[model samples]
Target: MDVTPVMSSASTPATGTTGSLAAMAQQAWGALSYAARTVGVPAGVRGLAVEVAYTAVHLSVYPWGLLDEALRPGGVHAHHRTDSLPPYERSRLVSDLDGSSTPVLLVHGIVDNRSIFHYLARTLRRRGHGTVQAVNYSPLTAFTGDIRTAARDLGDHVERLCAVSGVDRVHIVGHSLGGLISRYYVQRLGGDARVDTLVTLGTPHRGSAIAHLLPPTLVPRQLQPGSDLLRELEEPAPDCRTRFLAVWSRMDQLIIPQRNARLEHPDLDVENVRLEHVGHMAMTIDPEVVHLVACRLGRTRSPRDRIAPVAAAG
Candidate 1:
């Protein structure tokens, strides 16, 4: 017997084969779990999940509203070419300025283009509000420079809107960081005279801690609590003539401790409207908010009435 034991040619290593199959199964399960968490859970959750996903996408890939123009055909341009147009042509609003009451200038927040206001703009128009124009600032600008520059640009746009509409004062509606910009214009840039009413939705007037999650860019830094820009904005504005209405949501994920959206300045005329279960982005398109804004714009309030900060549950 040359070979003590003859190995069976057809025999397989059962333990090794079983171990490999188990490893593959585990890997497959991990992939499936990841997919479910990313796609399935977010789809079901809806509110905060949608906002978070949108924000993440905006920050990571679509910063500065890139590809937004592609999404919206013939919508408002990211950069208005008023400089090229004649005064007569430039003065015209999206809707007929003459027929509308007070012209409304809509300012979008960080990394957002004018398209974000499409639904709200249409709603305002349907409700018979005046010229609803939206402005888009460079997302990179917000990340690189002071917000005051955007406020200055806003001032320029406001002046143009007023000049074209033949209105002495225009109403301003700002969302998120745009609210901060409008506030800076009103408080620091002497825009109170030109702006009659300012309505802010989900704006962090006192700044937000969640800003820390963003890169330490100029505007993000400015948005952090106790930043210089916010401190300056907090200063007394005794002469500010603008009436401010702050609409904030309890479910807003961006503005941590959401009360930061309230305008707490003593000298300014401010009001707080609390919205429940509304995400930050949804505020711009909310029907109840739009109706409330229309009512505010439609009626004329006395100075005494505008001075007090009133809180209402929405």
Candidate 2:
């Protein structure tokens, strides 16, 4: 993505001042008020019951997502073309000041397939997003695949998508283990050059204890709390250009302490969005998560807009 600096003189009367103390104070007070209003867990009984039911639904849909989706020549379908949208629909869908047509790819968690993204993909298209795709990594690969190996494969996939779509950069949204894999690709494998934004939902950025409870496998071993693979990811990635957003849920059952999902590396630009009442498997279908993703992905990439969205839902 091109990094240009500044707004036109008409919008920002002051030439050099990027921020002001008074404005910050008002923002802080507003954030505090919003946080106070949203303090609760698991969205109450309704959310938990729905989460349980969705697991079975997702399982039944899993087989349908097993086959890799064929790459389209133009990256998106007929309706996703923004120019073809009717005026009213276009106004509702194109929220960005610069109208980014960035292609989005959804990566699923372990033992899950692209089927998890059915709701999210359709929602994004309705929001006027140009291209949305989902990829599946085989569960059989777990016996031989480690994080770096999977990351290498992911890198190749991103390159192909960029080429096929004829776009300079793409945004990635990874769920659970898929997030970790995408992170390794961006930070360690130089995928930052191609991936504009990387959003992780319920990913274990600090590693998770659940891996230790499960039987050892090539991938699970790498996901353990203190594994060498996780340690490597902890290393400084100051040069990575891709923006990071880690969306973690308080009710996620698979991530041992739950808090491990937050990405706190000092070197990277990361925004952490906290969620409540959503579980691991249910995150993709959750309305709050789907909306947050659509809003973030729809925004134009500018240096100024990259720093906000803190505790968006508390």
Candidate 3:
């Protein structure tokens, strides 16, 4: 049996490993024209040129996120409450434990650490999400570990966050491969019990053709189209209660067709939103993405029957 990604025609460049990215940039420049106009940025080649520069900037940020983050101390745990407070003050404390105070967990993609959310976390806090934080799975897992094992570890992290935050549920924003690990936890490992909303940015929900270019290592093999792991995720998920918001970008060269980022399952409650001119790594810091994520977490907007292009205010 032939086992490879559906888009096997996506060939690597003769120059070397990175030459493929340069080729994708050229394609992105052509495809990004209309999207650039929508965001009032320079069109076509110029738009993707900026994205290339941002990719370099994101590389500088990778070092800062090398270590796991410490849990911020702000959860309204029961031990912290007291009876000596005024009635009005006590009521406020009670409200803090309600759904309004649900925690937000940020998960980074393969080969990355919690530092990917440096800007996104700060932006969420600035937008009034008090408990926004990130959990860094081991970077080695991207190449050497089973995704199922990683999901189990993530579930453990979620439980710890719940214990400290005094809330039963949380909202998650997973970038790229991080999104896959999180979904495996949610759908296959019964994580819907804890996660209320899962937002995946640049996640290849249907598998990415780019994985075919790499050697068939354990984890990368699973990321290829029609891999066993992807097949397992495609299985029926009838009772999943957690909501999903999948964000895909037109200028994301890493995901190959880019539409691979869209999540389309028959039984899951999902909303897919598309954006133009944003690169795979740029999803976290893009002003529009930050604004949309804030609105979703803050409950500023209701679910829509149709997916629409949203532009953030300046």
Candidate 2 lDDT by residue in tens digits, 1-314: 55344435555645234457667788889756643443343354556677789998988877777643543333354445557776754775456524346778888888777889999988886777667888888776556667788889988888887777677688999999899999999999988877878999999998888888766887888888888888998898865678888999767778866789999998888999988777788888888889998888875475434323322322
TM-score of each: 0.68, 0.77, 0.74
TM-score of 1: 0.68
Candidate 1 regions off by >4 Å? Answer: 1-99, 300-314
Question: By descending TM-score, how would the candidates be arranged?
Answer: 2, 3, 1
Clashing pairs in 1: none
Which pairs clash in the backbone of model 3? 109-178
lDDT of each candidate versus the true structure: 0.74, 0.78, 0.77
Model 1, range 32-148, lDDT digits (tens) per residue?
Answer: 664455345543356556566655554554443446545654333333344554444444433444324577788888777666676777776655554677777776866686799
Model 3 lDDT per residue over 155-249, tens place: 99899988887777788999999999999999999898788789999999888889888666788888988899999999998667678999998
- Using lDDT as the measure, the top candidate is 2
Worst 10 residues of 3 by lDDT: 305-314
